[model samples]
Each structure stands twice: as C-alpha cells, then as structure tokens.
Target: MDTRQRLRTSALVCAAAVGMLISGCSSGSSFSEASAPSGSSVASPPGAVSTEELKTYYAQRLSWRDCGVPGFQCATLRAPLDYAKPDGRSVDLAVARVKATGPGKRIGSLLVNPGGPGGSAVSYLQGYAGVGYPAPVRARYDMVAIDPRGVARSEPVECLDDKDMDSYTQTDQTPDDKPEVAKLSTAFKGFAAGCKSRSATVLPHVSTVDAARDMDILRGVLGDEKLSYVGASYGTFLGATYAELYPDRVGRLVLDGAMDPSLPARQVNRDQTAGFETAFKSFADDCVQRALCPLGTTSPEDAATRLKDFFAKTDAQPIPTGESRPLTESLATTGVIAAMYDAGAWPQLREALTQAMAGDGSGLLALSDSYYEREPDGTYTNLMYANAAVNCLDAPPAFTTPNEVDAAVADFEKASPVFGRGFAWASLNCAYWPAPATGSPHRIEAKGAAPILVVGTTRDPATPYKWAQSLADQLSSGTLLTYEGDGHTAYGRGSDCVDTAINTYLLEGTPPRANKRCT
Candidate 1:
C-alpha cells in the first residue's frame, strides 16, 4: 500500500458524498456527566490534559438548534485550536445528533465516525448512521457526530480553487523525469501554500491527536460516562488515539476497518497499495466471469497488464469523453482507484474500463469526479485539503523529496506494480507543508482501556486486514473481529455474522470472543 491509496481511503464521514465508498451530532448548551476523563493517563502519555484544567470547557453549554432535518439537531462548540495553549484561540466544531428512537432503557450516546480524518461526521449522522444503524442500537442510544475541527462544517481547511484543483488532480503523479518531477513538486507546494494561506488559523491544529482531544470534549459535553464509538477507516486512528489519551473513558469502541497507529505514513501508504492490488485482483477475477469484462481475460496479472497499457495509451493520447476534458492516464487511474474501494462498485468499474477501452471516457470520468468530490459545475469541497492537512500534521511526510520517492519506488512496486509509483509520488504532497507536525509515529497501546473491538475485512482495499490485527494486538484489551470477505469495512455490509457480533457489542457491551473470525 503506497500513499496514493491512503488518500483514496478517506471516506466523507459514514455517508458516501459521491455514493462511491463508505465511511455525525448533538449539542445542548449544557448537560451533566457525573465525571469527566480523569487526570490518569495510562502509559504515562504526556499529551493527556488533566480533568481539572478542562472543567470549564466540559461544563460549557451548547446552544442546539433544529437544523434543516427533522429529528436532527445541530450546534456549535469551541475547542482550543492548540491544546498546548488552552487559554489561546479556539475553533468552532459542528455537531449533530438524532435522539434514541426506541422505548428501551437508553444506553447513553453512540458516537460514529466514517473513516476520513476529514470526513463530516454531521453529514454522516444526518444522512446515514443516524437513521440507517440497527434499530435496537438506535433505540437505546442517541447517535452523535461531530465535524472534527478543520473538517466540513467545522473550521475547514481550504486549498486550491475548483479550476485549480481540476488541473492539480490531473497532474501526472507518475512523473518520469526531472521536469515532470518539478511539475509535481510545484503542484504540491501550491496545494500546501493554498491551505496555509487560506486556513492558517485552522490547518496547524487539525491533527488526529487534536481531534481525539475534541472527541473527549464531545464525550464530556454529551454527558456520557464513557465514549462509545463506531469509527471506520481513518476514523479508527482517531478512536485509537482517544483510547490512548483517555483509556479510562473508553466504552464499547468498535474500530471498523481499523488503522494501525504504530505504522508511519509511508508504511501505511505502502500497505494500502498492496491492499488495492488485492482488491483489483478480486475485481479482475469477478470481471472475467462477466460478459462485459474490459480486460477480456481471466488472468489477473494479464488484466493488470492490459490496464497498464490503457493508462499508457491515455497518457500519450487522452481519450475523448462527452465533456471537454479528455480522459488522461491520471484520471483513469483515479477512476479505477475509486471503484476498488467496494466490491459492489466492480460492475461500474468494468463498464467504465470497457467504455474507456472503446475511447469513450465518460464513465471513467464520472468515477474520478466522484472520488474527488468534484461537481459538474467545477466547484470542489475541502475534503482533499483537510485530508492533507490532518494527514500531514498527524505524521511527517513519507518522502521529503522526489529523489527519496525515486529511491522508494522499487519497494512500492514490489508491493503493487499497478499503484506503487503513482502512490509514492502522491505522498510528496505533505513534504512542503507549512506547519511542523505536532504528532510523531508511535503506538497507541491504550494500556488501561476496557475491551476495544477492532474489525477487519479480508480484502479491504483502503485499510488492509493486517492493520486491524496489528491494532488489536497492540491495545491493552483490544479484541480482533475478522470479517472474511471483501470491501473497505466489515460491519453493516450484509454479513450476518459480522453484524451480529458488532450489534451484540454495541448493544449489550459484551464483546465477541477474542480473535473471532466471521465469514
């Protein structure tokens, strides 16, 4: 898994903004939680803020209002932009929630995050999890989401404008020479500059650790005894960090499509590249069984080879789509990456590939558009900007220079021939970030936390299953739940065994047997 795959892995909350891949809130001006996170920081974590210091913040009341949606409430709360200076500036966090629906004993609040560190938890809660989650769980607990600082509805990080981003995303990531490398470098520099200039106040404060602290704030404000969470994809990282910081406050954590906090940015990206290859192979195998198979062969290697040939062809002479923009190799690869997220989207990928192979690039273009959250009008959201902001701040760049990336290509190629070079170069986006990272590469053992459930899918493209295993192994009381199937995450994707186990945990607080494997 190289870095490009990691970027594609950030979901827009639990709801699919473009309906492509998977992955919010409440406020009261005031509520009474009997106790807040203690000063006790297990493992002697230096980052944890003592309960005494945060009392004023925890006691602050939120002024909730009826948002556009019925049964959904929205509000804003202020979190210190930087935890180091608690008396310093603050950033507004957007929150939303749907109250429990059933007449059962309420089980407190159930907070959900849909993977991307930048994903909008408010939109997710309002659109999907708030209503789509299991009835029993919904009945028992209020579904909550918070647009973590520097995310949508929060103080979002803004980079390039739409037209500029259109040009930026199409920049050739697999640069072959010095001139091309400089072009890619310029794009990255411009993107980092854009964020720093437009969102300087917020960009430096959006690290996962900052977000984890915000989650504790949410737990305190929600008046919950502990934090019960369902975090997917990159959200798993946030949840784990929270556990690491507030081990005593952990309650029924389900880290679906879990990420290993121990792995640095480069290793994570490389692993994700391999995961994409695994998923691509699965898609290819499935494609061969269909009549519209674009690769037109049963061999997965041959399929990859043929697809590479298509990318080369597009690189030289981009195919014409219905729109003015031609389908370049970069765009085509983005389209393919988008589909590799979910097995359900394989048919769409095949059709897109088939259409592209026939010189009509509309289908592929749409997929690429969806992945980037690009609208037809050429406007764009801040997903990519916040993604880079949080990611770069959470960990240092995988490569600091094009030469370093060149040196890493061989290992990445060994990981995934299809995505290695592109992803490796893609990692350079953070090298030029203006803010020095606040966090470092370290393991979150959560040494005193109660049972934390880490879920994994066998062939998940974005977050590989091994990450879940690693996370479960590292945590003080983490339980590994294996979903032996495909797609990004395991729960709520039609696996009866996986759903039942998670539902049981989320509902009853009784975790499945350790290392439980569900097919």
Candidate 2:
C-alpha cells in the first residue's frame, strides 16, 4: 500500500484495522457437527502421517458443543509456549466454529481471519464470516476462527486505558514546531511503553510469523492435514506467512486486500498514499459532476486544494462541534480521508464537508468519530491502542529521526501532493516507540503449499492492488485474483465474479486460474 493510503488505512485503527470479518465462533470446545467428512479433511504432514491418519485425528477430536453463536461451538486448543522452543510452557488458543449446515457433504474445517493484526478472528467467525459466507460454501465446510495470541480473547495486548487512547487519537498527527514534535514523540513513547509495561511477555510473540505458527497448531488440533483459510488485509499477510512456513499444509487459501511483505515500511506507506489519491480522484470525479459538490470545484485537484485549505483553517482555529472540544485539522482530515475508502461513503463525506465548511462541525466530527470507533459520549474502543501496539511490534520504524521523517514527508507530499505529508509523518510514530521493534518486514514464500489465491481490488484505498501483485509474485504458490472495482475487500462486498471464484475455490479446493481478473 502507498504511504497516504497506509496512513489512512492504518489510521483507521491504524492501517491494520481494515482486516477481514467473519462470524460464528465462541470460546470453548463444542463446534456444531458437519454432515459428512471428506477424505482429504486433515492435510498430511510431509512424510509423517498419511491422509487417512490425518482424517482420523480430526474425526475423533472434533467434539461439538453449543457455542454462543447459537449453531456454533467453541473450543480451546493448546499450542507450544513458543514455536521456536516447542518443549516450553503452553498457551491456550481460543478457537470457535459453526459446523457446515448441511447433511450432504463436509470438507475439513476452514479457518478465517479478519486482519487487524489484532482483529478478533473468533469474533469475525461468530459475527460475520461463519454465517455470512456464501451459503453454498458454508454448507460444505466447517467454518472456524481462532483469535491469535495477543488479540482479543487470546491473551489480548492492553496498551493504554480509554482516556489514554482518547488522548492518543486526538494528539496532533501533524506537528508545526519542535515542541509539537516532541509531544508527538512523547505520545508514541508513552503508548509503546504502555504496551511494554502492560503486555511485555506476549509482545515478543505477536509477530506475523508467530501468528502463522499459531494457525498451524490450530490446524493440527482441528485435525486438518492442511489449513484452509480466507484472510483479508493484514490477515493476508498472516495467511501468506503460513503458506510460506508450511506450504505443504496449505489447503484452499485465499488472501484478500493482500499486503506485500517484501516491501520496506516506507515504500508500502507511500504506495498506500498513492492508492488513496486514486480512490480520492474517483470520489472527486463523481463529486464534481454533481451540482451539490461541497467543494464547488471543477477538478479533483481543486477539491483537494479546498480540503487542504479547510484543514489549515481548522488547524489555526478549531471549530466547536457542540462538544467540549473543538474539531482540529487532524480530526478534520481524518474524517475526509475516511470517506475516500468506499465510494458509497462519498455522498456522506460530501455532506459532512459541506456542513463543516459552512461553520457546523458535527458532520465531519461524526465521520471522525466513526473512523476512530468512538461513541458520541466521548468513549473510545481499544482498537487504536491495539492497532499501534501490534504495528509497532510487527515492523521496525521506516526512519529513525524526525528529520528523516520530515524529508520523507516532503517526498510523500510531492508524490500525492495531498495526503503525503500527513501520512509520511504518521509513519514516524514507530520511530518514537519506547520499545525496540520486535519484527521487521520479511518475504513469505509458501513454497510447498497448495495453490493459494491472492485477491486484490484495483482501486482499494487501504491496500492498493499492487500489493496483491507483489505478494503473488513473492509467494511460490500464489495465484492472483483481481477485483476490478473500488473497495477495501472484495469477497462479500458485491462482486459476483470475485465471490464466485473464491467460493468455488473454498468449497472445492480449486484455485482461480492464475492472474484471473473480475469485476
């Protein structure tokens, strides 16, 4: 993803929040029953077990009990305390599932992850993916979700309190002077220190690779010889890592809104910045043709100029939104940027901008609130805090100092001429992290894995299409599936072609022909 896009994407809880969503998983060991088991249910480990043995492992251990998701059941599985040190202590991973609702045929369990790097996969299963997945596909495969360690219900990472998160989200992402810069740096340090102090032991184990390993253990517990998964956004990274680490264990896998791990933090950030520009241009093009465009501009550039001007004005003089605090530039920009993701949100953004420009700030404020997952009562979710903590630990900082970030920001602005600066500077957050990075960008090539489907949206703002291409190129068994549309994710967002292709692959263990494009 480009920098500006990454900033907006990541900023939406931190680009990491735009992960996938699945429904139907709870917290203990009783998943619903499947109609019939397929012969290839559990994948066979290299030269270790036969397919029949793997199937037996799954058939015998899958105890069905009612989970909170009415028809679903929850289960806990024990994994090694550390993959690197398999003989150490043990960590219990929370796994949930909804058995295929059919009496006809059953494939092994299909695992799904919504990509927060910290998003609760089990929650996704219980709430969305388990039930909402294409019905035909759901009828044939046991749907499952496992909340990775350091995520919700799986030894979650607690960085800051609600008040701390509120302050962190409202802190100026754009600094005007040395003191402001120091304040920004202090906020980063404080947030990082909070994670280190509150969730220290688990910090070292939250990397994408570690999460991938955890998934493998879940695969073993479920008696699936191979892992079948649908990962969105950051989950794509996780899925891809699994493919790389245990290629031979990969069953029908799909990665949506794929991220290219081979790219350095800065390049990924910049590319995402450009992506937002593309999405913005699409929004602006639609807005300008309308008679009521808030900007009253003829072109996207003019609309962007108007936005920058408004942001500057807000920075100089905050506008009261009928709340205790007034709207600032950062908040205003965040609100505007949030709308650029899905074109369906454009009209709402236009109305919000019009109201903001006309001296009323509630509209824009509301947008910001939604983007930050904040309620009208000034309460906040832990999404942002969790986002930052996970991101800071997953990758090292792109730059080491404010000056370096400033230079990068200038370059970003030159590239986007709109969102570059804001996003570029946002990248600096990791630079000020109190704890050193526990992970760095790495390439994942699931060499011996089955065909893995990698999905990309051509105009996706959060994770640009190029990322999918990059990831497909990097993975040994990667197959690129393109959605020629606009949106963050494609599966259930309304593309028959995208959905059909993925559903077919998920249900029948088929991969879309390599480099397939759909609209």
Candidate 3:
C-alpha cells in the first residue's frame, strides 16, 4: 500500500540485478508492429472513451523539450485526466527517447518497458532496456521509454513519507494472531489511504488499460505509424492490452514474462505464490547441493521446512541486524523472495541466508534493503509506491476479509510451503486501496495483430511459466518462446538460444513459432 510495497516487484527486479546488470548486453541497434489487439474481452469500464476521443486527447497535447541528458531528448505530453472527457483536465506523462545513431538502416522507433507496471519507462530506457538491448536492433531504431502516469517523474502518486514507509515495510507479513492480522490490515489500509489523500486525482487513470492508451499516444508523438515494443514482466500485460485495444496499430511486440489476462485476481495471486515456491524449491535444491548452504539439509523439502521454521522463529522473535530496525519475518521473507526472480542472485541469496540463520543478519537485511531500494543512507525510491497504486487500481483487491485470506492460505501454503502465506497476505494490500477497480481479468486475443512473441522461463518467480502458455493460447497471434531455465524474465537473462531467437524476431520480423522451446 505504501510506496515501498507498491514497487516491490519492480524494485526486486533491480536489487537482484546489482550483479546481473554488470554482465548484461548493452550495445544497441533498432528495428521495429501490426493490427489491433484481438483476444478475449472484459466488459469495458464505465465512461470508456471512443477512439476519436482518445485520439483527440493525444493530438491536442503540447510537448516541451527538456535536457534529460546528452544523448536523449525529453518531453512531457498532456493526456486527459479521464479519457472519457477528452476536453477536461489533463495529466502530464514524461517521455524520453534517444534517436537512432543510424549510419546503418532506419527501421523505426521502438518503445521499451522494463516491467513495473510501476517501473519508470524513462529510467529503464536510459539505464537498462535502451542502452543494453542488442546492438543490431539499437542501430536501426530510436529507443524510447515513457514513464506511465502516476509513476516516478510523471506527477507521481505518493502514499507514504520516508518514516511511514519504513514502518510499512517492516510490518509483519506473517500473522501469528488476530492482533497481527489486524496490524497487517491496518498497514494495508493506511498505505492505501496515503495514496487516496496524496494522489486522488490520477489514481483512477493508472490502470494497465490507461497505460496502454498512453503508449499509443507516445507512438503518435514519435511519428511512428505503428507500435513497436519490448515489454518485460508486467509490461507484457500493458503491451498485450495495447495490442488488443489498438490491434491495427500493433507493429512488432515482444512480451517477456507475460501475464495471463484470463486469471482472476485471487488466482493470479495464488499462482504467483506457487511460482515463488517453485523458485524457492529450485533454490533449495541447488542450495543443499552447494557447500555454502547453511540451512543444512540433504533434500529441498527439508531445506524448505527449515526455512518455514526459521520464518516462524522470526515471527516469534525477530533478529536484530544492528540497524535502527531489526530483521522481521516480513523483511527476511521479502529478501529471499526477491532473489527468486533471477538465478544470478542465487550465490548472494545463499550467503544472505547463511548469515541470517547464523545470527548475523546484515546480508539478508541488505537484500531486503536492495529489494525495497532503500539506499544505504535510508532514503527510498518511489518504485514500491507506484507499483502498489497501479496494481491495486488496475484490478480489484485480492481479498475482502481476513477469512478470505485464511481460506486461500491453505492452498498458498501447499503451493510453496515456504512463501505461500506471506505472498497471500502481500496480495491483500489492494484490499484496502482507495481506488475502485476499473479493469478486470480477461484474455487478450489480438486476433488481427501480427505474430507477437511471448517469452517465459520455466521457473519464473513473479509471472509464472503457465501464465505465458495461457497467454500465448489466448492471443490469436501469440507465439510462445520457452526458456527451460530459471529466473523471472527471459530475453536477455543470459542464453544464446533465447537471445538470438528474440533478436532475430526483433531485427527480422520473424516470430518464433507458438511451440518454440529453447534450453
């Protein structure tokens, strides 16, 4: 609910990348999508604007150039506060793009989203997605990132001050009693209320659908005839929505760690709970086999039981890390959970866990700090706040009451005996959100769109592998590209088979087939 939790998934993407990014591909080149998004449908939100209204909202906007840096041009575009009233109030969206350094071939502009539904597309463009994308693709097209409305540097939605966020992040995730459950609920409510009071105007406009529409405007502003994009994690959902809403405008799209729009909110939460469990199992299996594993068990199941017991102990008595704050079960779990996103962090995770279980909590504490983007100096990024705001608004809260949470806990526990209970409650942050749901889960057919690549990892933590399969099946033009490996996302997570296949598609306009699988 507070900004910290809101950006949890997005921040985890970065924290786990402290080392991965060091070795990631960074040279860039570019090339660029087809028809409308034609999958399944959810009922349109009330006051849905017509295409003309949407177009008018985009066209009337003025852009002012600002110096983002040496190589990129930055501007802000105004879109209607509410799309249905095109002539009404407006909100500014920050946009950035580095023009292609073409001495090669001019393909087109390519928009890139680095997940986060809450992640800053502009930051992603400048930092990771833009500069680090493969060279051939970068050389051919201008690389761009748009910070979604209600996200960082775009009239952001604020939910907590630094102090309040600190408390919110340390709130007990595993409820041991009625009072603890109430505390958790209160934390969720307080976090939600902060957003309502601070960012009331635009909370309603931050849905995935709204972001998708905004992407279209960016396409028009960039002078691109169609939308060409690469979206990772939740960005996959935004990209799919764009394809569905403006199928005719979809040019070339690659959705990595795709979300299955057909799953209900609770189902989505449960499935993700299971995914973390699966990832943990993989971690445990590998951990026990390694010399450094501190939990010390021969089998993954035993290692998992050891972790659950450790969490239970932390809940009963949290361990101090010598900081002003101690390591609570919630923070500890979050730290471990964060590592599940990328296998590259497995070594660090092992070290962190060993230190924590041995009474030296600095390593696990540091991992949690990284995941929360809590800098060593104690300041925090707005990523978590935006992550929660967008997630809560795009869909209904996952649970209505503690009983509902309790009912789901058994299944969640079964899914990943170590992570299920905590994630089940983490999903509840939206239950107390102030914004009403403007979107519902629905399958995107993308029937008339060109072939779209849907990449998935077998052991992805945030967006599970099955969701990718389901999404591919749901989309009329969907092609499933499988990486039988570990990590939250594919594409550039270090695989020649995976990287070359996707690069070929982005560069040559040839999507791997629906059943394509790479080791």
Candidate 4:
C-alpha cells in the first residue's frame, strides 16, 4: 500500500455510506461437506519445548466453527502480540476457510489476502476468493483467509469515532495556511494517540513482517506442508515477506498488484501518485471520447487541467450534497481517487464529476465514501485505522512534518499536477504515529522458495507495474506475469489470459514464463 491504501486502497468515500460494493469476490454456490480430517488439525507442540516459543503457537489446535457461509468455518488463530517477546501476550486472529470440493485429490490450503495492509482477508475469502476462484483450483484446494492483527476482527485498532472521522476526512489536507496545517497535524496526532490508547500492544505488532510471521503460524496450524498463497497490492508485500522468511516452506505464491519493498515510503507514495496519474491519463483518454466527460472531449493533458481546476473550485466552495455533509476539497480529491482504482469506475466518476460540476455533490460524496469505506450506519471499518498502524510500523513517514511536505510540493507537483499535492499530504498521515517504524525499505530475496509469480497490471493505480517488475527482478526465483492492461489488479478482471496463467501455477505448480505478457 502507498503507506494509507498510499497505505490500503482508498476506502469508499461517499457511496460506502449506503454500503460499499467492491468488485470481485463472487458469492459461489453452496459448499460441500468437509473432506479433510479434523484430527489432522495442528495442536500445541508436544514434548520438550525448544527455544522457539512460536513453535508452541504453531501447534495449537484451531477449533473451527461454522460461520455464515455454508462450508466456511471460522477459527481463532493465536500469535504473540510482540514476536520479540513470543513467551509473552498473545493476540487471537480471526481466520475463516471453505474446504475444497474435489473430484481431484485435495491439494492442501490456498491462503488469499486482498491488498489492504488492513483489508480483511477473511471477508475477501468469504465474499470473493472462496467461490470466485477458478473452479478447477477451488476443486483441488481449500480457500482460506485470516485477518491480520490490528485489522478487522483480529484485535482491531480503533481511532476516531464516526462523527470525528467525518470531520477528519473533511479536514483540509491541502492546507493553505498554518492554521489548516496545525488542524491536520492535530488530527494525525490524535488518530495515532487513539490507536495507541485502544490497541497499545496490537498497534506496535501489526507490521507486514509481523503479519508474515502470523501467516507462517497459520500455515503450520492449517496442516499445510507448504504455503500456497495469493496476495494483492499490500498483500503482495506480506506474501513476499513470507516467502523470504520461509523460502523452503513456500509452495506456490502469487503476488498481484505487487509492492516493491525496496522503496522508501515517499518514493512509494510518489510513484503511486504517478501511477494514479497514469491511470487518470488512461481514464481521460477514454473520457475525452465520451460526451458525458465533465472535463470535456479534449486531450488527456487538457482533461487533467480541467479536472485540477474543478478541484480548485470545490476547494474554494465546498459542494453541498443533499445530506448535511458538503463535499470538501479533500473529499473531492479522494472521490476522484476512488474512481481511479478500477477502470469500471470511470463512468461513475464522470457522472460524479458532472454532478459536482453541476453544484450537486452527492455523486462525488458517494465516490469519496467508497474511498473511506464509511457504512450507511456511519460506522467506519478498522481499515483506515489498521492501514495507518501497519503502514507507519513498516516504514518512516513520507514527510516528517507539514514543512517537509511543503518543501517537496514542487517535486510532487512535477510528478502529477492532479494528484501530487494530495498524495504528498496523504503521505504525512503516518508522520505523527505513536510508535516508531520497525521496518525499512529493503529487498526480500526469497532464495530457496519455489517459483513465486508476480502479477503487474500496466496501469495499476495503487500498486504500479514497475513495482512488480522490480520485485520480480529482486526475488531469486520470481516470475513476472504482465497484464498489458489498465486497473488495479489483473486477476479475474475479465482476463482469461491472466487468470489461466495464475490458475496453472496454483494447480500444476507451473510458473508463467519469466516476464510473460498477457493482454
């Protein structure tokens, strides 16, 4: 993640107020009876305990109880809140799995993680991956997910309440004065303090590396000899870390919408800003040909200029939606960002922009809601909270202060006039984090791991294509699967080419030829 969805993808800003509908994750048909033996389930380590206290954790019996879905059973996974103190406190992680329905022999477990450092892997599996995965793949393997610590339902981290978040999200990110900057800084500090207060232990332990360790524990507990996994966006970082930490134990790992752990937080955020610009150009290229385009039927550059001007206008005079909340500059920019996540959202963006230009902000508010994941009940998910928690712990802040962001403004503006300013400011979200970053920008060369597949979309807004190439090049046995297209991720986004290659790898243990391009 950029270090916010520059750490998780933008939560739905406006529309999530109704109910956020993210694409992918189909609700599959009813699941069949469990085929795997329960006795084989992992249990606490027996005999003399070694120095590795984690071994004891890896051996615990995970009691599975049927959740809402037919074959999907929920279980609690316990891991040390602080890996450095493994003999100390434990955190109960939420895990869910839908056993494979097979005509072929069961092929162990396939763990799936959606992009958010904070995105609920359990929800991703139950909603999409469990039933939405390839039929052959589903038939041969069990689909599983776990909510990493500090994320949803896994000792979730809490920050601002609904009304406070409403105000926070509306706070002027593109501050024009010292007062605005102070207000933004205060909000950042306040959010960090809230996480520290509510999730003191969990907050410090939710880094990507920590999450990877949790995955290894989950892998052992699931009775899998080797870990087979699929992770997207920030999830890719988690998967890559796992492969690096436990190379020999890696079965088949797929990293879609890959993040380059090699880059600093600023570079990642800056690169993502550019990537979103790339996506915007793609959107503008398409929009200019459409009459509904609010930016008018003009060149991409021209379209971007007009859109920037629109943000300027909204910034000056917030657009009033039918609701009490009016669309502010930050919300408007986020609304624009939500649409850039997937090409399918372009039309909605165009409509939203048109409505905003028409002085009705409801459409744009909905788009912003999509970015924030604010539900109709006005309750927010732990997404943004955990996103910042994990992101801040993974790396240092992009800008140490508002002044630093100001100093870098020109560089960012040079990066993307439309998004640079907003992203530069967004990068500072972790600046006031209570805990210092535990990890730094580095390479994860999973030397002895089985072939790990890295999927890169040509114009991914969040995780850019270059990141996949970089990660593929860094990994000892990495294979790059290029989706020569637009959007955040390639898998199951109407791409038989991308899906087939990934499916073959998962089922047959065949990696796509290195640097293979799929259209």
* Candidate number achieving the greatest lDDT relative to the actual structure: 1
What are the runs in model 1 whose C-alpha is more than 4 Å off? 1-33, 42-49
lDDT of 4 by residue, 382-496 (tens): 7788778878888877788888989998898887888887777777777788888888899988887889999999988778899999999999999999999988878888889
Index of the highest-TM-score prediction: 1
Candidate 1 C-alpha lDDT tens digits along 259-361: 8888777887888878888988888888777766889766778888898888888988889998778898888888898887777677777877888898899
Q: Model 2, range 1-519, lDDT digits (tens) per residue?
A: 122222232223224431110000212222222311232432222222332323322333434567756887877666554555544555666778887887658887888887766667777787778788898878888898888877777777787777776667667777889998888778777877887788777766666666776676567656566788988888888887777666667788898888888877778778878887788878877888899999765888898788778888988888888876678777787787777656667777898788888888877777777666566566754455455656666777766788898767777887677677777777776676555666667777766677889999999877889989988988887889999988677888788999999988887778889889998
Worst 10 residues of 3 by lDDT: 16-25
RMSD of each: 4.1, 6.2, 5.5, 6.5
lDDT of 3 by residue, 316-428 (tens): 78887988888888788877876777776787778878888888777777777767668767887677777877777777777888889988888888887787777677767
lDDT of each: 0.79, 0.71, 0.75, 0.78
Which prediction has more favorable TM-score, 1 or 3?
A: 1
lDDT of 3: 0.75
Off by over 4 Å in 2: 1-67, 86-89, 375-379
List residue ranges in candidate 3 displaced over 4 A. 1-45, 54-57, 60-68
